[model samples]
Target: MSPANPVAGDERRRLVEDVIQRRILSTELRPGQRVNESRLAEELVVSRTPVREALLRLEGQGWVLFDHGRGFVVTPLSTDEIRETYPIVAQLEQLALTSTGPALRGLAPVLSEINGEFGASTDPARSHDLDARFHRTLASRCGNGRLIALLDRHWQALHRYERFYMTHPDDHRRSVRQHDAIVAAIASGDVASAADQLVDNIIGPMHVLLERLR
Candidate 1:
């Protein structure tokens, strides 16, 4: 198998990480799905070593679980896990929001562009991308590399729930409006309002998802 792009060892690891992360988050790899190492290596055109390494990383991150006889299965999150995670996520988002200063002002236009695309998007896949981008951009500005990395990991772990919300018609519509509120609050430098709006935006859809799962 040929590498699509030539990259060094660390870069190749990141590429593998990205591939697995995206597949899991997009639900291409559903919960409890067994990860076929050989098949994945063949499809991704990478050696088994990197694929194994990637799977190990994902397992450590709680996105995958080791089954006694089944090898690695995508981790399934319960409603309780979702509920337990939201408040922690909210607190992290609030920290990021409060830490924002002038550096974040540059993100305003990018956020607006993403919001515009999200509003006009009729494709579910495209909408999910936009949604991910919006939150990721917000978190990336927190000025703490470790915090940002942790959030990225959490985001990937929560992707299944997030996608469920994004693909639901009613939830998607509500998200657009809520995203606007968040953007407006941030643009106005109302940190507290932005934090509250972020929590609401996260928890509201999560409520819908939890109800559906129940």
Candidate 2:
């Protein structure tokens, strides 16, 4: 009945958004599952307003969709979605890395270390996290906040797909090698080569996931 505090409302909306995004990315919410606004509000101890607002924001981010009768549901994964989204994300990441310029030189060691752990890890979640970290770190010095944010959103959207397809043993080995090559290129001050390798790192698994989807 009363008015909501503006600051508190913003905080709650962001919190709700992040929680839902994480669930979707981890596949805990799952593809095509209805997102119950009332239930999520109760679980998060927030009002339905924030939950609804967050879901709407997520819809814009391609994480969920508003169905006429079913309300908000997790966006179902499809080969079409993969073909459309993966290349865009790959290009954005390539741009981010190329734009990072000399700053990427400083991150070469860090990226290599992360790739090492990513390859060594047996846990899917940990490996996924490390892989995300590697890509993010590689582009962190790009100095373009909007570009980075956009890339992060796309990366998170693709995370669910990547996590789902990570069961293939060969994919794991191939990713490690690709990441290693990217790091090597970066370490050698070959930014163009690193960017090319980074695109391959992304598009390579894209084909693998498409095959698995078939």
How well is each residue in 89-203 modelled by candidate 2, as lDDT tens digits? Answer: 9999999888887788889888888988999988777778888888888878899999998988888678778887665667888899999999899889999898888899899
Model 1 pairs in collision: none
Model 2 / residue 59 / CA error / Å: 1.1
**Ten contiguous residues minimizing lDDT sum, candidate 1:** 4-13
- Top lDDT prediction, candidate number: 2
Query: Could you give candidate 1's per-residue lDDT for residues 1-214 as a string of tens digits?
Result: 8775545655767788888777877789888899898898788787887887888888898878899899888888678878877777777777886787776667777888898899988877788889989988887777898888777766766777777677778778888998888888878877788788888988887788788888
Error of 2 at 162 (Å): 2.5
What lDDT would each prediction earn against the true structure?
0.81, 0.87
RMSD value for candidate 1: 3.8
The TM-score, computed over Cα atoms with residue i paired to residue i, of candidate 1 is 0.81
RMSD values for the candidates in order, in angstroms, are 3.8, 2.4
Clashes of 1: 0
Residue 171, candidate 2: how far off, in angstroms?
1.9
